[model samples]
Target: MRVMHVLKTVSKAAPTSLHRSASKTSTRGRKSPVQRATAGAITITHADRVVYPGESITKGDVAAYYQRVMTSLLPNVVKRPLSVIRCPEGARNTCFFQKHPMGGLHHVGTIELKEEKGSLATYMYAKNASSILELVQFGAMEFHVWSTRIDRLETTDRVVFDLDPSPRVTWERIVAAARLLKVQLDELELTSFVRTSGGKGLHVVLPVNPACSWDLVKDFSHAIATRMATGQPQEFVDTASKTKRAGKIYVDYLRNTRGATSIANYSLRTRKNAPVATPLRWEELSKIEGGDAFTIRSLPRRLSRLRKDPWENIDSVKQTLSAAMKKLEVGA
Candidate 1:
């Protein structure tokens, strides 16, 4: 919708309280509109239903959060193929992960994607406010995006290094691992950004030239992970083997592969308190306590107070894997 609408809602916002307006009162023999909240053209049904029971956060509250963050969220997700987690009843209830459209929602549009089996599949994407709100209406809790935009499906424009920490690993070590990766990336003359995965890890992302193939991108990422694990065997592991992950951080490079996805920035996680996958400045990492430190209830305040976006320069950054690739190949 309008930018003003987004600004107004966020400026005068809080987690939706439990009170209902008089207009929302039900009439005899008539369906009540209390359960739905409408913006300009989009409507979120079950607005009063509790999605996060622990926080008493309602569907409307989630919708409001999306609206408030849409300016920031849309850039990372719009026009990208998505795999969403839908919690139909609520976050505490049954949830299913979906990549292709199953024929219910109209606002969330679908694109034909070529699958590995040489078959065309319909993948979902949201271009604007209505489509995003439609997903909130569809009970979508988390949004994951592929590395490439739909326009350039085979050409990846981004690289993501997911630092998946073992349960025994402390948050401090996780932070340290990200900084170390940053140092390595810096040495290669590549600029990178960082964000919380909203789970147990951090994602170091870099915007790359879209000319690179998925194979090249994935190989480069694997090289970085391998080099890190080799240099610091005591703190890092490169493989996905669960048994080897104990007391270390797993540098998950697989998300750079074709069709792989990472949680989009500003997206909510399907967790208690509705934690957000938040982006932070490198300096802010040491100050932040955990990956799930910022929830839907607290993120708006943080956003309002921030002087500049942590990833403000991400879109302007232009780099390729060319130089980095040669270094890894020689090192190998």
Candidate 2:
């Protein structure tokens, strides 16, 4: 099961330095410009409201981060069904995950999807930059997207392995697990990309042709994860059971299933300091210290400094899993 972290209520007495700085810059008579800030066509309200009180990151700051990362962020989320972590009051207060559309947020679009049991369900999706900012305005802090797009709801486009590690696992071991998966994927002729989960793990993504059924994709991912866990019993576990997960990395292939969503790259995590689910070049893995290595404050700077996007060709690489799935099934 996935754990949701709510921002604990911060005491009024302990204010962050960033908050203090904002207070010092306030004009005596006029409203602060930050009270309402624009992103694309949407004006974010309560812009000065601190969402991440520990870091004094306000709703406006979150909007700004989205504005800055929209180019890289949009591709992963646009037109895909979404589930968001909403912290309306702030990161240090109450929050909830919203999968369906809430009333009065017409700016955010919704698509009606048929559920497994035959009932119709409406899920929200971002149409563009403004739609995303509108969601931020609606209190969404983290954006999670489905593997399939709205246009092709039945066919998935990617295989995601969320490498969740037990507390006892070291960073080195986690890196090894990722590289090991890469090698295995290469052997099966599947190209994979790596990213931080923005929490405690890495997401190894395989961009595949949207021709496979969800069951086929899920089973294929499970097979790969199972193969690794069984081959390296001491280092990995394929199951999500916490009892079997101690001191080992859990190859969570569950993200590949229908209705399942993974954190969109560049999305802010609900954790303190607003860590970002950042994409990394395979070679950059050794340099990262942890999953939360890139936070909102640091990500824009990192992007500005990078010569090229780490997952530059992700949208273009539509490799199918047919060959790899067959290879794995045959134990080749």
Candidate 3:
């Protein structure tokens, strides 16, 4: 009877061992191509250390970096699908990704190409490295890359509001600018999003319908800037000179270039590893300290309390650039 019991126990153990082996095999096979590539080639010595070389980076390295960083920095944003574009040859690399999380250090998704004409090293060194380091050490990694071919996306029209206050510009002036833009957009029935530039200004963005052309988008932006300037000439600076810009707000429409890309909303910037541009409600602008209150370090926690997403109804609001321009021409 004892011998019979031992045999039964051995038989049960064999099935369990077989099951475990099969499970492991299945997991190994299910990993995406990018995951497999990352596992085989990339090595992380410290969380915040990143090496940007003069040589070309392989697709595998890019994939691995994206996977690792996005997993942490972009956990919430990744619920949506993503695409990766290769950095073109001769493009200036004005940014670096941090390897570790530290002072406001967080994972970043996009990199700035800088001035369309600079050496890779020149571009890399141009950004605020201290800020970038902070983000890598402390922020999440949900990073992505874009190539010149990114225009292929259905959405070609981009509306950027370049914002900056005059030297010695008070915080109240900045808040007033935001409120004016918000009210104007609301009047037009167009949806818009707001973010601090991580500097002296605030950027107000509007997503255009994929059908719009670049020219139409530029014209619409010009109209808005002109209108804002006319409404508040004293507070809104539209002059081209730095000296004249004192006590005024500049409504920049130049960010609509073919190769231009705005820092991703909520993306952590390499400069000072400051948190990427943050989405803000109009009301918060009045309460928060303009320069000191926002940074790459504090954005994650601030995002947790937001009940409504600024771009939640983006699909419904997408409109043709021509249509938008026509409306703006009529001062709609």
Best by lDDT: 2
How well does candidate 2 score on lDDT at residue 315? 82
Error of 1 at 13 (Å): 16
Q: Local distance difference test, per candidate? A: 0.84, 0.85, 0.46
- Residue pairs clashing in model 1 are none
Model 1 poorest 10 in a row by lDDT: 2-11
- How many angstroms is residue 27 displaced in model 1 relative to the true structure, after the best TM-score fit? 9.4
| TM per candidate | 0.90, 0.90, 0.57
Better of 1 and 3 by lDDT: 1
Please provide the root mean square deviation of candidate 2 (C-alpha atoms, Å). Answer: 6.2
Candidate 1 regions with alpha-carbon error over 4 angstroms: 1-33
> Which ten contiguous residues of candidate 2 have the minimum total lDDT?
9-18
Clash numbers, per candidate: 0, 1, 47
lDDT per residue, candidate 3, 1-332, as tens digits? Answer: 00100000000000100001111235556632221211212222232123223323322332333332332333223222122111211112322232111222123223323334642211111022222222222222323212112224323434778688877888777877877887887777777767777666788877766566555666677788888888777777555678767878888876665444454555433233333456666567777677435443355456555676644554466655555556677864
Error of 2 at 332 (Å): 7.7
